[model samples]
Target: MTHRTLFLTGAAIALVATAGLGFGLGRLTDKTPAAAEGHAEEADHEENFIALSVADAAKAGVLTTTVGRGGGSELVLPGRVALAVNALAALGAPVSGAVERVHVAVGDHVSAGAAIASLRGAEGANARASVDVAAAGARAAAAAAARDRRLFEAGVVARQDWEASQAAADKAQAELRAARAQVTAQGTPSAGGLATLRAPIAGIITRVDVRVGAFLTQGGLVAEIADQSAVEYVFDAPPASVGAIKVGDEVLVQRPDGGEDSARIVAVAPSAVDAGAAVVRAKPTAPAPRIGSIVSARVILAKGAGGLTVPADAVQTLEGRAVVFVVEPKGFRATPVITGRAAEGAVEILKGLNGGETIAGKGAFRLKAELGKGEAGHED
Candidate 1:
């Protein structure tokens, strides 16, 4: 064979060897199932992510996100239901007397001018008799005065005599008026035979301090009538809390019978009661509060003005500044923010953040610790 033919034959031989090697390599690469299984095991190791257990999270007081509305803060106050002072009536005797009869009993509803009790007094009878005598004298004097005036007009009587008669009649009339005023002032029935103790205002009889034949002093209370037409809640709170409460602020009244009523703060005592507790007065809705009933008061302190706010737990204290942890794609970041009035569980966000930002609702302390640990590790 010539030299060129020998080289061509060598090249063909090398090509056949290369084909054999390629075929062996292809067979070795054909075990795809085993390689895939190995790769899956390796991924499983990397998938072992860490997370907190349910019990642990609960123990840490971890909470989830919830949408909060306006009106953020309220201060709870303890109070008791009371009768409006104006609605209370103390059935007292205008003169010293013995209770002849109790016209009404406890829990009875009475109207204005309705009799609740009757009193018999010595002064009362004397007052009636004096008024009657004065009225009779007044009629006689009036007739005499009219005759004297006619005589003076006709020039048949001396001017001094007519004037004297007029003066006498005037004096008698004044005496009669005085006697009638005395009777009225004694609470005697006006033109009626019985001196009945009538209700000054319409309401329920909450107390009966007198029975038949009970002796009472002048102006002494005999029964207590409560006009439950309007009820009030009386509260004694600390002076520190007084600044947050004001008239016309909304109040929540909680009853022991599992009932709730709404009211407005109508009054606040100018000074403290017992020099320790401040007096607060509120007027509840209709269906008046039972006298002396106990209730709870929730006075609003701060209200939201339709701004961004978050739960207090979401805020973290860092380096003496109010900080909140915001979870980002990379990790959590401590963000300083300005806050406004806080109510209940929410606080107003005045600055440093806008609404719709996802913040760490809970478990932010753990992230903070992790960051601290990372910093220590780097220092080491």
Candidate 2:
């Protein structure tokens, strides 16, 4: 062959080889069946995550909640929300010391006996020691009082002597009682002198005033907590209407915010004076309305009902099944759930939920309508 012909033939061979190599690599890199299935699953998961910002959620009127077991029996009455006696607590330092840590923040839920903050108690050790000392003194005083009583009864001591001894014992007892109060007011300290401030009752932290490393004085406010669920509805029942109102009646509470909850009559007291309106106190079965909110309360007379429930509006029907839009980190997820009886503007949940899930309330319908747009309105 000539030189030009030879060069052209070699170039054609190289081009064909390059094409074959590219085809082979493309085949190898193509996704396998299993890999393709996995990709679909991931896409599905991403699709399930609804993307809504906090502000949008607020504008949509989405109210979140942790599901709680509730009483479904019902009644209707007008009432105002009020904190239960002892439901509100303004916790202060157990003893004068610098704050070591604040364990909770505003809007956090806390259980009874759970620690909310910790501080080094300057008088912790001394307080414990004082309790020990007082206890010994109390024991000694009791023993002496017993001895004097026996002597007086036996006619072996003057009446005045016995009386004086009794008085001395009383004085000692008072001193001991005072000393013990000091210890109790300041919780027992850890070996390292840390005094943990615990919630007096299960509640929500409404305020936090202590900062880490800040010196707190004894009795200085550290935080404030209110048992959101530990509230009672006070209704003024007319004397004629009061006869029908009785304890143990169920109440469905409607708040101004368009949220609903249930409570049960715990007390019904007539006015101390003549013809005054009777007072009816109902303890809430679910988390309560904010203190001081005027609410419409429905009292149900029946019994044999109890289950996990949320606001009736919170439950929505989609695709022929009941679903609630549960709040998620990114947005809301429509979770299929089994529901029971409906009463008092609320519905019972039989399955498909554990407690402590934040869910959409008032604005639930908006979510359902938005979600009804299917994969079109909500995109991954």
- Estimate the TM-score of every prediction: 0.58, 0.39
Q: What range of 10 consecutive residues in model 2 has the weakest lDDT sum?
A: 42-51
Query: Distance (Å) between predicted and true CA of 312, model 2?
Result: 35
lDDT of all predictions: 0.73, 0.78
lDDT per residue as tens, model 1, 195-238 = 67788889888898888988888888878888776667898776
Question: How big is the RMSD of model 1?
Answer: 17.7
lDDT of 2: 0.78
**Candidate 2 lDDT over residue span 155-257, tens digit each:** 9988888888788788888988887787677877754567788898788999999899899888899989998666778987655446556787777788898
The TM-score that candidate 2 achieves is 0.39
Instruction: List residue ranges in candidate 1 displaced over 4 A.
Output: 1-73, 158-164, 189-194, 255-260, 270-274, 301-380
How far off is residue 130 in model 2, in Å? Answer: 5.1
- Regions of candidate 2 where Cα sits further than 4 Å from its true position: 1-76, 128-185, 190-193, 212-217, 239-244, 249-263, 269-278, 284-293, 298-380
